[model samples]
Target chain A: MPSEAQAAPDILSVELARIAQDIDSSFDLLLPVPDDPRRPLVEAMRYAAIGGGKRLRPLLLVATAEMHAVDRDTALRVACAIEAIHVYSLIHDDLPCMDDDDMRHGKPTVHRKFDEATAVLAGDALHAFAFEILSDPMTGGGDPFVRAELIYTLAMASGANGMAGGQMMDMMAESSRFDLPTVTRLQQLKTGALLGAAVEMGAILGRVVPEGRTHLRGFARDVGLAFQIADDLLDAEGDEVAAGKALRKDEAAGKETFLSLLGPQRARAQAEMLVEQAISHLASCGAEADILRALARYVVERDR
Target chain B: MPSEAQAAPDILSVELARIAQDIDSSFDLLLPVPDDPRRPLVEAMRYAAIGGGKRLRPLLLVATAEMHAVDRDTALRVACAIEAIHVYSLIHDDLPCMDDDDMRHGKPTVHRKFDEATAVLAGDALHAFAFEILSDPMTGGGDPFVRAELIYTLAMASGANGMAGGQMMDMMAESSRFDLPTVTRLQQLKTGALLGAAVEMGAILGRVVPEGRTHLRGFARDVGLAFQIADDLLDAEGDEVAAGKALRKDEAAGKETFLSLLGPQRARAQAEMLVEQAISHLASCGAEADILRALARYVVERDR
Candidate 1:
C-alpha cells in the first residue's frame, strides 16, 4: 500500500484511471454484441455504458469493498450493476422529454445517435440487466441471500422512492421555487441515495456489522452532498468544454440549485466543509479508508 | 374443480374476472398511497397498474402455478411482480416519444393524466419495484435461492433479450418492411417472451423438472401466438370503443400484422388452431389445468 503521506491527488487520479479501465473491460465482457435484429438496443446500451464518465460510483464501491477484503471480481460485479443504473439514468435524463441535452461525456447522447425509441428501450434494458447481474449467483459468489439483499438494496436505491423519485423532483423544481432544505432533500434523493447505496453495498459485501455500516452510510451522505455541491458549482461557473456538456444550464433554465441558492463563494465553502465532514465519518477505518478520503476531496476539487 | 365438459367461455370469463379482482387488490395493497411530494409518482404507478386491461399475464402465471399446487400467496406475489412489469411497459409504450397515445383502458394514459416526465419516472420505478418484489424473501416466500431465481428470471424476461428488445424491434418495424417470418419473430420477442416467462415462472415456483417445464413452454408459446393474432384481429376489425384504443392503426400506418398478411378469415382460423394446440400441450396435466385450457380458448375469443 502507498504511504499515507503520498500526494492525495496523484493517488486519486491513478486509482480513478485504473478503476475506469477495469470497469470498461468488465462492461465489454458483460455486454456482448447481439446476433439478433434488436442488436441496436445492445449497441445503444454498450454505447451509453462504455467509454464515459469518471466511474466514481463504482470506484467507491470497489474501494469500500477492498477495505473489507471482498474478492475483486465479486465487488466488480456489484460495481458494474450500480454503474449500469447510473448510465441508464443518464440516457433517460438526456431524452427529449427530459433535459434534452445533445451531448454527454463529450460524445453524442444515446437518443441523438440512436433514435428516441431505441434509447428508451436501451435504458430500460440496462435497468433490468442491473438486477439480472446482482441476482445471478455467479456475480455474487454463490450466495443467494447476499444476491437477494443486493437486489433489494439496489431496487430501493433505484425505484420510485429513490433515483427515479429524485429525477421527478428535479423536473418539478424547474417550475417551482425550491428552498435550500427542499433542494438538499432533492439532491439527497436524486444523487445521495445511490451514492450512499454504493457505500452500503460495499458494507453489505464486506458483511460489516450494523454499527460499521452506519459510519460508512454517514461517510457516503456527506460525500454525496459535497459531490452535488461541486456539481452545482461546475454547472454555474465551470467551462462547458471541460465539463463535456453544457454548463450554467441550471442558471439558464432559472433552476434553483445549491449554487444558485448559496452563491459561488458560500457554495465553495460549504463543499469544503462537507468534504471534511465526509472524511471525518471514516475516522474509525484508519489508513484503509485513504482512498475514500482522497475521493471525498476529489469530488469537490475535480474540474469535471 | 370444474369438469372438462363445462362451457369454456363461462369458465374463462369467471376465472378472468376473479384473477383481475385479486390482482387489483394485491396491487392496491402492494402500492400504497405515498406521503411525499413525489406522491404523484406512486399515484401514476397505481393508476397505470390498478385499473387496467385484463390481467392476462398474471392470470397465466397463477393458473400455471395452481396446476402445480404452488401456494396461492407465493404465486400471487410473483404474479403481481410480472403484472408490475407489464404495467410499466404499457406506461412507457404510451409515452409521447414512443406510441404517443392519449387513452388506454378507456382512460387517459399515464402521460395524459399525469405529465410526460412523471409517466416516465413512474414506469421506471415500477420496473425497479418488480425486481424488488421478486428478490424480497417475504414476497417470493422465505427462500433466498427462490427469490434470487425469481429475480434472475424476471430480469431476463424484461431486459434486452425480451420485452424491451421486442419494443425496439416493433419500433424498427414501423420504418421497415417485415415479411411473415420476421413479423412472427418480432411478435415472439416483443410479446411471446414475457408471456412465455409467465408460465416459466410458475414452473420455477412449482420446482418442476426441466422436462416437465418443456411441455408448459410449448403451451405458453402457442397461447402467446394465438393471443397476438387475436390482438391483430381486434385492431383490424374490433370497435375502437370496445378496444379502448385506436383501431386499424396498423393498417393506417401500413404496418404488417397477422391480419394484414393472412387476411381476416385466415388470421381467425390460425388463432383458433393455435389455441387448440395450446390446450393440447397441457393434455398430460389433467383436470388441474382446466383453467389454462379455458384460457387458451379465451385468448382467441375475448373482445377486449
Candidate 2:
C-alpha cells in the first residue's frame, strides 16, 4: 500500500486522472443515443454527464464491489449509473432557483454553461439516462429483479429522504439554531446516505452476508461524517485557491456546521476518532480497502 | 363498459372518488409510520398523493397488469406506486418557480394549501415513498429485481428526458412558435413516458412477453398522446368546473399546445384516432383488456 507521505504527488495525480478518465469514458459509452429528434437532448445529456466531477462516488462503488470479490467489470455499469444520478442531482441543485451556485469544480455550473432551460432538460435527461442504463438488460443480465433493486436503492438514497432530504434540512438550518445532533443528522442524510448506499450497494452486488454488510455500513457511516467535518475544517483553515470552492463559505452563508457547533479543536478530534473507527471497521476487509481508507483520511488531511 | 355520454355526471364523480379512496386506503396500509417529527411530512405526502386528480395512471397500470393475468391484489402495490410518483411530479410542477399553478383538480395547489417549502418536501418525500413501497420485501415478495426495474422505469419516465424534459420544452415553447412535431414530441415525453411506464410496469410485473409487451407499448403510446391532446382540447373548450383546472390557462400563458398548433377540431380528431389505435392494439389480449380500453377512451372523451 502506498503511504501518504511516500506517494509521489505527480504519480498520484496521474493515476487519479486515469481513473477519472476511465469512469468518464465508460459513462459516455453507456448514454442513450436514440435516432429520434430527441437526439439533441440525448447528446446534451451525454455532454453534461461525461464532462465533470472527480468520480469519487463511482470510485467508491468500484472499490467497495472489489472488496467483496465482485469483478470490477460487473460493477462498472452500476458505477456509471451512480455518477449519472450524482451529476443530475448537482445539475438540479445548481439551478438558479435552487442553490444558485455560479460555479462547481471551477467550471460554470450546468445552468451557466448551458441555458437554464437546457440545463433543466439536460438534468432531466441525465436522470432518465441513469435509469435507462440500470434497466438496460445488458447491464443486469436480463434479470429484471436485480435491475429493479438497483434502481430502488439508488432512488431512495438520492431522492428526498436521502441526499435531497439532507439538502432540505441544510437549507432549513440556515436560519435555525441546529444542535450537534441536528447537524449530524443532516450530514448523515445528505452525504452519508449516498456514501452508505455506495458501499451497501457493493455488498448487495457482491452478495456479502449479514455480518460483512453491517461492518461495511459502519465504516461508510463513520468515514462519511468524519470526511464532512474535515471539509468544514478545511474551509475554516484553507485558502480559496487551495480549496477550489470559496473558503469559509459556510460561515459566510451563516450555516450551522460541525465547526460552528463543536469548535475547531474538538471538531478535528472527532474527525480523527471517526477515521480510527472507519479503519478499525475495515481491518478484516484487507488490502482492497486501503484506497478507501486513505481517501477518507485525505478528506480531512487535504488542504482542498 | 361505461359509455361516455351514458356515464352521468354524478356517477363519474362517484367513480373517481371511489378510485381515489381505494388508492388512498391501500397506500395508508403500506407506508411505514415515521417518528413524530416526520409524521406530518408523511401525512402531507399522502394528502398530495391521494386527494388530487382522477387516478388515470394507476388505472392504466392495474388494468394492464390484470390483462396480463396478474391478480389485481398483487398489482395494487404497483398501482399505488405509479400514482405516488405521478402526484409527486405534479406537486413539483405547481411550485412557484416551476409551472406556478395556483389550482389543480379544482382545489388550491399543494403549495398553496400548505406552504412552498412543505410542498417541495412533500413532493420529494412522495418520490422516495414510491420507491420504498416498491422495495419493501414483503410487498410483491420483495422481488428486488422487479422493484429495481420499476424504480428505474419510473425514474426515467419522471426525470429529465421524460416528464421533466417535456416540461422544459413546454416552458421553452411558451415564447417560441413551436410546430406540430415539437408539440407532439413534448407531449410524448412529458405526458407519455409515465403513462407508458405505468402500463409497461404492470406488464413487467405480470411477466407479459412476446407480442403482448409490444402491443401494450403500442397501445400505451397512442393512449398517452391521446390523453395529452384531450387535455389540450379541454383547456381550450372545457369549463374550469368541468376540467378541474384553470381553463384557457394554456392559451393565456402563450404556451404551444396541440389545440394551438392543430386547431381544436383537428386536435379532438387526432385524439380520437389515437384512442382507436390504442383499442386496436389491445384486440388480441381478450376481454380482460376491456378496462384498459375504456380508460383510454375515457381520457379523451370525458367532460373533465
Candidate 3:
C-alpha cells in the first residue's frame, strides 16, 4: 500500500474519491427519510449533500487526520460534518436572494429542484446536522474535550466571524469599492475560514495542540487563498460545462476578484506561488502528508 | 425574594421580564458589531435577537436549570443559545420565500428591515453562534461531556428530525389535508422539539441523567403542545396589535391546526388540559420548580 501510494502520481485524487463515497454513505445513514411530510426536507438535504462537489474539505480533513493516525471512522464523521457545512453554505449562497445560481454540482440547485422554502429549510437542517455529527452520542470514542473543540472551531469558522462574515463583505463588494487588502481579508474569511477549519478540525481530532498546528495552519491559509484565486480563474475562463455553474457572474456583478484585480496571467502566477508556499509549510511533515501536499497543488490546478 | 415569589400572583411575568433583559444583554455582548463591512450582518443579528419575543424559551431553560442548582451564568449562556436558535428560525421563517412576514415584534421582519440576503446570513450566523456559545472555551467551567450533550440535544431539536422537519410538515399542511394525528406529530416537531431541548439542556447542565429527566421531558412535551394550541387560539381570536406580528394566516392558507382540527371550544379545553398535565408533571419537584409550574400555566395564558 505504501509503495502504491508513493508510486501514484495523484494520491490525492484516490483519497478524494474514497472520502466522497464514505461521506455520502455516512450522510445516507444520518438522514433517513421518515414516512411523513418532513421527508421532503430530508430529501432536499440528501439531494444537495450526496454525490456532489469535489469533497475537497472532507478530503483535507481526512488527510490531515492521518498525520496523527486518528481512527478512520471518526475522521470520516468529522469530514462529513465539514462537507455538510460547505454544502449548506452553497445551497444558501445559490438562493435567488443571494447568488441566484440555478445550477450546482452539475444539477439543479436545491431551490431550483425543490422550491425556495425547501431550499432554506434544507440548508438550515444541514447546518444543524454538522453540529449533530460533531457531537454525536456514538462519537467514535472521541474525547469530549476534542469533540467540543471540533464544534467550536467549526462554528467559529462558519459563523459571523468567519465564512458568513465574508459573505456579507461579498454582498457589499458589489456596491462598494474594495482594495486588495479588503478583498484579501474577505477571501480569508469567506473561503479561507472553512478551509482552515477542515485542517484545524483534523488536528483537533488528532489531539494536536494549537501550538503544534502552526505549520498546518500556514498550509491551510495559503491553500485557501490559492483555492479562491483558482475559483476566480474558473469563473473567468474555465468551461461552464465542466464548472457546472454560471460563470463571469462576479464580473457581471462588478465584484472585485483576484482575477479582475490582477489580470488573468498575474492571478494565475499568484495562485501557483501560493500553492508552492502551502506545500512548503508541510516540509516538516513526513511522507504521510504527501496527500495534503498534493491537495495544495490540486487546489489551483483542478478544473472546478 | 422567596416571600416576593410566593406573594406574586404572576411571577411568570416577573421572570419573563427578567429573562428578556438578561438575554438581550447576553446577545448584545455575544454579537458586537465589528468595524468592517460585516458590521451589517452583526447588526441584523442584534436587531433580531436583542429586544424581541417573550423570551419564554430562555425563561423555561433558566427555571429548569434552577431546579438542579446549576450555575446561574452558565444557565444564562445556554439560555441565550436556545433563544438564538429560536430567533434564527423565526428570521428564516419570516423570509419572503417562506412565510413572507412583513412585521415582527411590532416592527418590520429582518427581511423587510434589511433585505433577504442579510436576513438569511444573519440567521445563518446566529445558528453558528448557538453552537459557538455551547462549545465556548469559557463555557461556564462546564463539564466537557455536558457541553457535548448540550450541543447534541440542541442540534437534534433544531435539525431535520426536529424543528426543520416539523416545519416541512407544516408547509405540507397548507397544500395537503392533515388529520389530528398528523397535525399532532407536526406540532411535536415544529414547536415542541426546541422547547424540549431547552428543558433537556438545563437538565443536562445539572447533570440530570436521561432516565431522571422523564418528568421534565413530559413537562416540556405538554407545554409545547399547549403552547401551540394557545397560539392557534390566539390566531383565531387574539389582538394582532398585541401579538406583534401577522396572525390568522394559517386560516388564510387553509392549513390544518389544532384549532381547525378540534374547533375553538374543544381546542381551548384540550390546551387547558395539557397545561394542567404539564403542571402535574412538575408536582414531584420542590418549590424551586414552582416557576416551571407557573410557566406551564403561562403557556396557555399568555396573549403574546
Best by lDDT: 3
The clash number for model 1 is 0
lDDT (Cα atoms) of all candidates against the true structure = 0.88, 0.75, 0.92
Quick one: best DockQ, which candidate? 3
Error of 2 at B60 (Å): 1.1
Residue-by-residue lDDT tens digits, candidate 2, B95-115: 776677888888888878876
Better of 2 and 3 by TM-score: 3
Per-residue CA lDDT of candidate 3, range B1-304, in tens? 8898678757777788888889989988888889999999999999999988998889888888888988888899999999999999999999988999999999999999999999999999999999999999777456788889999999999999899999989999999999999999999999999999999988988889999999999999999999999999999998999999988898999998999989999999999999999989988888899889888888888888
lDDT of 1 by residue, A152-225 (tens): 88998998778988887888788889999989989999999999899988888988876768789889999999
Better of 2 and 3 by DockQ: 3
Q: Which of the predicted structures, 1 or 3, would earn the higher TM-score when compared with the native?
A: 3
Least well predicted 10-residue stretch by lDDT in candidate 1 chain B:
B1-10
Q: Please report the TM-score between candidate 3 and the true structure.
A: 0.97
Off by over 4 Å in 2: A1-15, A32-48, A115-121, A140-148, B1-15, B29-44, B113-121, B139-145, B159-161, B253-255
Q: Model 1: how far is A136 from its true place, Å? A: 2.0
Return the lDDT, model 3, position A119.
Answer: 98
lDDT of 2 at A189: 84
Docking class of 1: medium
Q: Which stretches of candidate 1 lie above 4 Å from their native place?
A: A1-9, B1-9
lDDT (0-100) at residue A187 of candidate 2?
91
